[model samples]
Target: MKALLLVVLAALPVSAKLVSREQRLDLVRRARLRQAVDPSTMDLLNGPQGDGSFKVGEAVSCKYEEKDPLHPLGGHSPKFPCWTKSGERLKVKYKGEANPEVYGEVAGSRLLWALGFYSERMYSVKIVCENCPADPWTSTKESPRAVRTFEPATVQRRLKGTEVSEVEGEGWKFSELDHVNPAKGGATQAEADALRLLAVFMNHGDNTANQQALTCLEGDPDCKAPVMYVTDIGGVFGGKGYFTSYRHWTKKKSLWKDAGNCVADYKTTDEKSNDPEISEAGRKLLADLLGKLSEKQVRDLFLGARFDDLSKRQPPFIWPDGKSRPLTVDDWVKAFLEKRAQVASARCPR
Candidate 1:
């Protein structure tokens, strides 16, 4: 019976083509089945270690292949480029029996179910292992481990009103607004405000991966606000302290210093020291934005919570001398919402 099943499975089609970004996102969003068994029985041939484990929020390495139900076996292949719902470009990698042929068919049916739980969408490719069996296939027994690889999706340059370049001496430039103030341009003001809020949260969360130039949008020369976007947030909520805590401190120092320096550099009056390329209005706008922030707001932005929460939960990070803190994500979220409401009401005024 096993021999017959192997013969039949071997005859079945096995390979597939690369999926477009739209299709891949759709699969991740809508797919109901989070896990699938390898039909090729490669795990049996290669032993339990060969089976792949899939977990929520864990990054997977996969590759793209032409869609074909009848191809042979292999593993570890390059993937094709795709886009995310947030308009960011990404690539998908496939491992195990996740080849295009298997993935394409399964993805269409399973995607919607997957999205019901995970708010974020995902893209996936397929792979094949040559040394796998073809009958009585079982999910390989092995500890769940996510494959590690640098995702190129987050690379960004130039936002509507921002010019991001690594020019020596001149420093990062945003030429849209006058010197020191970021509010000169209406659109720039909105973008800057959004980034400021985001930066505060990121700083508190200690998200180093996002600290660099990750989420930036290009186009719209008239607007000069730096582009910021949130990519892979898996590391946001929970993780080991060694990796997460270290990153927290490292990112905090780097972002705080760079952001503060950038603000100070643009706000300075000395044209010789300031980048000549930056507009006076832009500098003024940055200064005004920074100026509007109270010391408490700055602290809150960095600490991310009310004093009450901190007393109860006691976050992992040490509070600066004489500083109050918040305890939970809920507490921080509530405070953030309240502050946003106040800012909106004050700025927009009915």
Candidate 2:
């Protein structure tokens, strides 16, 4: 079907219509933030259409692909390409030293989605290793690369002048178009403000374009405007942890506790600024979304990343000082709730 669409589009003359960067970004922001007021639509998108939330008792299976790339994060934990019994393919990683990283990624994705931000579907599925190939750990593996999240036609349209370049310094073997820095181009004021607020809220320090992808509705290349999603979100929710050098995550209420009218690190321009119109709406939307979740649902969001066999408290966390305590599901949920309150209070005052 996609091939046929491409063929049909190819026969037509190139779209002489030029879409300005601002227009494209505005379209994207609307599509993303629009989900807030539409519950029925949210359910539909969050359902099987988009990456739905993981369900309890879902059958899961795993098999190691020696050719699959290993994420640097999996150094302590192992990762494998897995499929739910329903045939949803996912990249599964075991939790060991990378426990917080996996949890943060899953939490961030869920929270952002709950708040109506476009995010890739991610969930926890326990891999039945019995069905996997022999000596999975011993098999040869390659380093991870950025997965192509956009359709071919959309990529061509959105990135006309941007050059695809190899990331120097990093030992990256793959190439992808640069699309992360919204300030460089292709970002609306609303999106810029929303993204910055989310970053501070989640302590998402990594705002590099590489961590994001401009995807479309139902993977359609010809969709009017491609929406942005954080396809790679493993680097989130690290507050004061010594090992959490990638993103800042804190259980304490600090980043946005007093977020008044401005976001740090984001510049104000005629085109983009800490606009109250966007930020105020975003705060209400996020707070309302967080209110809809139950403690159990929040707990499930965290456990969704860990192996199924582990108990709710099975993977007890140890701090850098060697003093260890189990990170309970309730405790995690409480932290989120506290943050949600702070966010609501920080919005443009009523």
Candidate 3:
């Protein structure tokens, strides 16, 4: 029976549609689904996603494939760009101390989901790559790239429901967001502003046009209106300067540029985030989403992202008294709540 099932699955045609930004935008314009900001689903928080585990067999196995220079994976770390055994494709993000993108991306993406935003379904796992190299990152210029025995390393499966535009950097910019910000059917200005507030709160570093996506949930047959989301948020939490600047993370909590005008201070000042024009509803949304997280959830978020430990390569720091203090999951939880309060409490004076 299992053999027959495998055969049937292998014969099935691909169901996903990789459309252009314009095409996806048109779908949103004519979307049938309610895209309202104040939907019934907004009433609850989704998750802090636990320990980031995946059961056996569910783990995706990928053989090394060419890295699309136009859309490369593993910004600083080693990545296995390959097709999986499940007849689907995804990039496997490997973890390392020198490459803090692994941890930041995991925690950042999870935070997006918890706040009711559509995001990449990244899960932590351990697996061996078939016919791989010791350093999977070597370009084609290197010789004998194929090796049979590769150690089982921690990799996060970047699930796709998220479609890419063939034209590089062809994503929705913050300025051109009126169509999808409050999208056409549902999302409101307040809701849109709240999302902007979110990016600032995290000090999102990769605030580029290409890092966002317009995607329908993976199995949606009737996806007239796909939700637009930030596809890459791995550059969050540690600020734009360093990948895991726990000190920077803890220090930067102020989120408002002008409380009276409802303006937010996006750490990276650009047209995409300047003067967000926040509203009361936006503040409430932040409060509603973040206020619901318990101490356990907050701790789990950072710990699961492997933020509990200190990186020796990131180098240690000393206090005025000459005492070294390691950044803990506890430090992150405190910073998260502090920033949450700053935004949630942001008042637009009448």
Candidate 4:
């Protein structure tokens, strides 16, 4: 099927009048998905593997490979693709050392992986591209020379799964749990509700329709019981503008609007947040997972994302400024524990 799609597409003229841009891209996406999938290798929680857990400061050399090559729209966050020496294709989304999203994305995925969820097999690795690109995250341009890229850049091995959502690129919604829940989509309802709570915990500000994905754990085209997973989590751990502000994040740590009825009132941009109500099971599940984190593991969450170096930036952090203050590992650990305490708080809805 993969070969046939390409063979047929290659035969068609570039000027095919009837095909829309979406149609053409969908064609390419499906073909690539089929070609790259290895059914036996499919595992939702397959990582936060050796690469994501260990490669900070030490540069992992890679050759730049242009995937999108061109960003349809220009943006600040520069994310592009590269192939490591071991031949793993990774998506690198790095802004710089000062940018909190770098830490947020890595921490979010790693935390999710730790909590036993299907998440990006992402690691924070220093990058040196042999054939570097100029703003490759949004432009197709490249440089011929080797370039040292951002520090603590998130390097995530691409995830593969059969599409289970009705819309291809536009993924499922928090409202549409039937598309990914076990009672309906095969993932536990507690998992779905816990995700909503998790989004609030992070004060997620970029929960777009396409951010979460619904897909089968298997690579089979006919795979049923698809599970939902967060495909991109870069904009977490902060509120408006996705800033890694300690004051803002810690200031509003409450997870409930009406704890007795299990209502949530944290910040979010997801319009599909209404259907799933928080349950005791969901809250407990998250709290239980968080409770399992050892002291070292809890600290690793921020250290892995390079939160310690944030205070040492050129223009050092100042007091009373949440955004400007240098958030050390200690600061993050304290905040994290407080947040965990909120999750496990005895005052939660029964």
Global lDDT of each candidate? 0.26, 0.42, 0.57, 0.59
**Tens digit per residue, CA lDDT, model 4, 1-350:** 12112111111111111233443233323321111122223221222445234455667777877554243323356676677777665667776654566767777776776666666556677877767765556444444445656676776643455433333455655565533424332456576667778777777767776776644444554433334567677777667564565656766656667766778775456656732358888788778767777767777677776766653542433455546544466776787888888788834455
The TM-score-based order of candidates, best leading, equals: 3, 4, 2, 1
lDDT of 3 by residue, 1-350 (tens): 00111111111122234555566566545322122233223211222234433532134466666556775553556666555566544456664555666667767776776666766655444445566666667655354555343222334433334343434335556654556443356466566666777777777756767676544555654564456677677778867656556777656556777777777766552455555666787677767777777767777666656664433334455567988865456666877888877876667752
Minimal lDDT window, size 10, model 1 = 1-10
lDDT of 3 at 254: 66
**Residue runs of model 2 more than 4 Å from their true location after superposition:** 1-54, 68-77, 82-90, 130-192, 239-248, 264-278, 294-296, 303-325, 347-350
Give the lDDT of residue 68 in candidate 2: 35
User: Who is ahead in lDDT, 1 or 3?
Assistant: 3
Write one digit per residue (lDDT tens) for candidate 2, span 1-350.
01112111111112212244454444334333224443222332122232334443343443333443433223443454544455544455544343444445555665666556766555543345434543333444333332211100000011111111122111111011123334443444444455556655565544455455443454344554445555555555553222222212344335443356533332121123222233565456555555676665555555553422222424455577989675555555565667656766665632
Candidate 4: lDDT of 308? Answer: 67
Candidate 4, number of clashes: 6
Which 10-residue window of candidate 4 scores lowest in summed lDDT? 7-16
The segments of candidate 3 whose C-alpha lies over 4 angstroms from its true place after superposition are 1-77, 82-90, 139-169, 181-183, 218-222, 309-313, 317-322
Query: How much RMSD separates candidate 4 from the native structure?
Result: 7.8
TM-score for each model: 0.25, 0.57, 0.74, 0.74
lDDT of 2 at 106: 52
